[model samples]
Target: MRKEAQELYRAEKDKIVLRPFTAKYPKIAPEESYRIQLALIEMKKADGAKVVGKKIGLTSKAMQKMLNVDQPDYGHILDNMVLPDAAVFLAGELIQPKIEPEIAFILDRELTGPGVTPTQVLAATRFVLPALEIIDSRIEGWKIKLCDTIADNASSARVVLGNSPKRVEEFDLKLIGMVLEKNGDIVQTGAGGAVLGHPAVAVAWLANAVGQFGVSLGAGEIVMPGALCAATDVSAGDLLQASFDGLGTVSVRFA
Candidate 1:
């Protein structure tokens, strides 16, 4: 990253308390965008936030093609970004909130390095749970290039994990289906295959990418393996539900 670009990135990140950035700075390349993201992560760490785990984005082939990226991208999810079940999220805190259904893996062992396989991810995982990711684009309307989204923490906002956890061997995850319901009506449907052929593959991609940054997936960290379906716009008073076959269901009500 150029010195001027780095300075601008840091300035924008430090000004988070004022208001999130709703537009992108022009001429930022993909690599430079990741540099800004890492810098922001460092800034957050300096402010006392603990890195919880990573989030994989654009795991779906459609999303990958739409974003014109061949592979997935990841972002750091801070501990403070997690919300427990039944918790309320102030609508005003987010810029443009969209919801996605995903499968979250809680690791029982640390995973690092490239060439990690999907089988390895399944073995390292303690359990898998249904998750609803509230993705708030600091960039307005969630409209931005791949680099813009990456710099914005893959549009991460808050993640809600379901109570029940299913063992990896207990279900046929590759064929698992997910139904997304809004206000009691099904809005979208998808399957684990929608996420880079399988959710575990997404985890593998995330593990490798994090390794490149000199980070490793730690035990007990929650890794969200991207969304199984396209994001749905959310509104206050709305009820969102995601049900995964055999794994279980997770729901949240907007206030």
Candidate 2:
């Protein structure tokens, strides 16, 4: 089941894949599914892919309700999955992509959690950067359960980072606001508090959670806290921008 899922993920890329894991592997434990994810990440590393950072997903209560999950999930971001701020994303290069406005934490120090706190997260954070997470599901029609998505690396695909990062001491993150726009019109608006009351809270959760799996989020690694607002679909010729009130802005052109 693990091997087949990995094959389908690689072959489908951004396209709809046939036969989800749950349909064949009924009653599979979420922990087992996460083990599959870890295996997949190891395979990527073997293939010369570098682990750029980690992302927390379904942290928002809204998204948790949508996905019918009580807890959040984490995924790896490969070196090639990151793009510069304002870069173009070829629509043809991805399967049914969706964009979410998020703030990224650049860690200045290592953190291993079974007890990581939000305050410790902020202290370890080097700065905050505006970000847009591009998520794509390999399953057909985005149909997935928690185990399915977890095995599929939490449905992560690409991330865009603002070139400039603000120091942690420079601002109060809870008050950070973001305006998400498509084609120059605001489509969604939210603040840092929308994500588990604060983005650092989400990051803290990720540290402690992933730590149980023997994964330590290292220093200088970028951590993508959950999206501030709901995700919006993307298509060819679409221009999307996420502007944080004080942090800065990042844009992606879909072509």
Candidate 3:
């Protein structure tokens, strides 16, 4: 079942949007879904994919409620999945894609725990930066339940990280603001608090949750805490930019 699911997803990567797993099978346990996620990622690793970092998703209360899931999910970040600052992402390479402005935590030290605190997350962080997490789901029409999303690697696609990296103490992250623009026009705006009250809160939540599965957030790993607002849709030839109040801006052109 695992290999079949993995091959199904691999074969249909950007070819067809898929039905939710729940729609096609009996209710799946979150643990089972996560196991499938690990298997798929491992398959990618066997194909020479390198682990770069991790991403936390569904951290917002609104997102949780929308998916009817009370807990957050995580996805692995591969070295090849990271685009340079302002890099263009080929629209032809994705299914249905969306973008969200977020704060990324670059860790200075390994963080592992079932009791990791936001303070610990901040203390271990080397710095933070403005980022845009490009999300794409293999799920058809984005009709996904929590298990479906979890099994699909939390719908992660790629990340566009900004250039300027600032120390956590250099600015107040919770009060930081952001303006998201598409094609040079502002389309959405938000503050850091929109991410589980504060962005680091999500990071802390991730460390503790994933740690239960024996995943340790390593030093030098980049952690995407979650989006600050609702995500914006993207299309070919659209240029998207996010400007943070303190952190500089990062842009991506869909081509």
The top-ranked prediction according to lDDT is 3
Residues 32-81 of candidate 2: C-alpha lDDT, one tens digit per residue? 88888888888778888999799989887767776677878888889989
Over 4 Å off in model 1, which ranges? 1-27, 65-70
Candidate numbers sorted by lDDT from highest down: 3, 2, 1
Per-prediction TM-score, please?
0.88, 0.95, 0.95
Please report how far candidate 1 places residue 82 from its true position, in Å.
Answer: 0.8
Candidate with more favorable, higher lDDT: 1 or 3 = 3
Steric collisions counted per model = 0, 1, 0
lDDT of 3 by residue, 210-254 (tens): 888788999999999988888788999999999999799999999
Q: What's the lDDT of the predicted structure labeled candidate 3?
A: 0.87
Model 2, runs deviating above 4 Å: none
Question: Which 10-residue window in model 3 sums to the lowest lDDT?
Answer: 4-13
Which candidate has the highest TM-score of all? 3
